[model samples]
Target: MIPVVPLDRSREAALRALVDGKAKPLGALGRIEDLAVRLALISGREDPSFDKALLLVFAGDHGLNQAGVSAYPSAVTTAMVATLLAGRASANAFARVVGAEVRVVDAGVAADLAPHPALVDAKVRRGTRNAASQPALTPDEVQSALARGAAVARRAVEAEGFDILAVGEMGIGNSASAALILHRLAPAPLADCIGLGAGHDAEGLARKHAVLAQAAARSDASDPPGVLAEFGGLEIIAMAGAILGAAAARTPVLVDGFIASTAALAAIRLEPAAADYCIFAHRSAEKGHALVLEAAGAEPLVDLSMRLGEGTGALLALPMVRAAAALLSEVASLDDVLAGRL
Candidate 1:
């Protein structure tokens, strides 16, 4: 097990000095400056750089889709996973543009995909059981999913030597599951966070809300592990573990869309220090996402009205992170300026 690192005062002081030296008035960059400082602290480097980036897309299926929560069929999860591995998914295109390696992990898709060289067969199960009808996953399944996610993070950090990790998910009806988890974990109402997931109409949205409400009522928020066991999808639980593992490894984690944010929330609850390593990649257009971000006090890097959950938003924001790092590492300091340095 990778040990978690607590944020140290020395690291914080170095971050402050670096940010204050940026080519702007102190604190003028606002949250962007804060973001750079946070990245520095998490990586334990006075100057942080995401020269090598890895985006892990964990695919699964939510049994809750049987309740009409999503317009797309559950098979779409497997299909998208295949598409991603084929380098044809939107996430692949975005990652290509940003020069980041994308890896697709089969967390728990319902479909039986034959051995494909492109796919990382980290299957925890065929898929989660219906949460609206029963528990989404068994305790063993949840534990296995988390362990798989952590293993993936370990490989990314130890083998690939990635400086930044982005989290993404593909699961039908997962938005509903995330909403339920958010409702239970956050001090927010279910209705406020529920949204028209995957282009659901009024009736579909109504049904999604109802299913989440039922799951929320039955959940025991006091026991987060139990809540996750009872209502969380494999992808969400896996993501929670990834966040914790990434933090333990002291790598900067870029949280993707709504589902990814909810997973981060779960990991944050488990270890509050984990938040120090997380970067809210974007403010998802999903109705519940904004509330989740607010509840966690996360200021996202982008607000392009993105609803995509395949780490596309996180990839889009990577350039900004790279730029921040470059400024810190390459830009001249105030001492250089005062000494008439060229």
Candidate 2:
């Protein structure tokens, strides 16, 4: 893993002063003011540019679905990838509204998909092994997924000139995998992390709980990479890589929903510095997401009772990100305002 340097705080005091001097009541912008400070810290500029944004939606399949963990079949993973590539998915719709370019990555879908220009072919395997009885990914596959995800992110920032990055995922049964990850990584109780992922009923939720217990019992690995290999979906691991990549590039990463936050947890655990670059997008309706966010000490930007896990929540927050940057760059200082410089 590439080491990420923590944001330099040499200018933090100065940035805060600048934000405070803006033509408005002190802290009138609420969290938006805090956001501007972070943006400045990331860009090394008092007036950071957040004009260009990219959304990476990683699609994969989880073999754990075979254990009746999800309400939907694993086949839905492939179908949703097609839906995203066709520009008809909720993520695509949200991206259009926010003016962020969307790219779908074939991280580890179970089936081969037809080639599409917008799709990134970074599949590490057909699908993860059922973690209920075995490790989901091999050690080598875990490294490959991380490297591929980093490559995708580096390309977006270095080649495509994207100013910010948001990561989302599509993997049937991934919520179960994410729950397992949060349970182990967050060190939260397994029952606390388990939730009605993809709308499971009472009986289905009970079954999910039992299967996840089996998975948890199968491994005692506590480190990030080991835990990821034990239970992470390909998309989840890839999203972790993307977060690391974005942080290494000194770009802000908008982590979306529960599965995405679980990935962020892995990245931050791997490199603690990566946590400084992440903006938790929203509080997902998924019950366990609150626990994951709490463990990370993250205050999400909004709560819309959404669990749609397609980067939609992140995209919806893009406007606020833009507003944060705008406040720093466009607003006048109190000194200038009093001088009638306008």
What is the C-alpha local distance difference test score of each model? 0.83, 0.92
The residue ranges of model 2 lying beyond 4 angstroms of the native Cα positions read none
Best by lDDT: 2
TM-score of each: 0.95, 0.99
TM-score of 2: 0.99
Off by over 4 Å in 1: 1-3
Encode model 2's per-residue lDDT on 1-342: one tens digit a residue.
Answer: 868999999888999999999999998989999999999999888778887999999989998999999999999988899899999999999999889999998899999899898899999999999999999999999999999998899889999899999999999999999999999899899999988988888999999999999999999988889999999699999999999999999999999999999999999999899999999999999979999898888999999999999899999989998999999999999999999997
- Displacement of residue 6 (Cα, Å) in model 2 is 0.2
Native-referenced Cα lDDT, model 2: 0.92
Kindly give the number of clashing pairs for every candidate.
Answer: 0, 0
Clashes counted in candidate 2 amount to 0
Residue 218 in candidate 2 has what lDDT?
93
Q: Which ten residues in a row have the lowest lDDT in candidate 2?
A: 43-52
TM-score of 1: 0.95
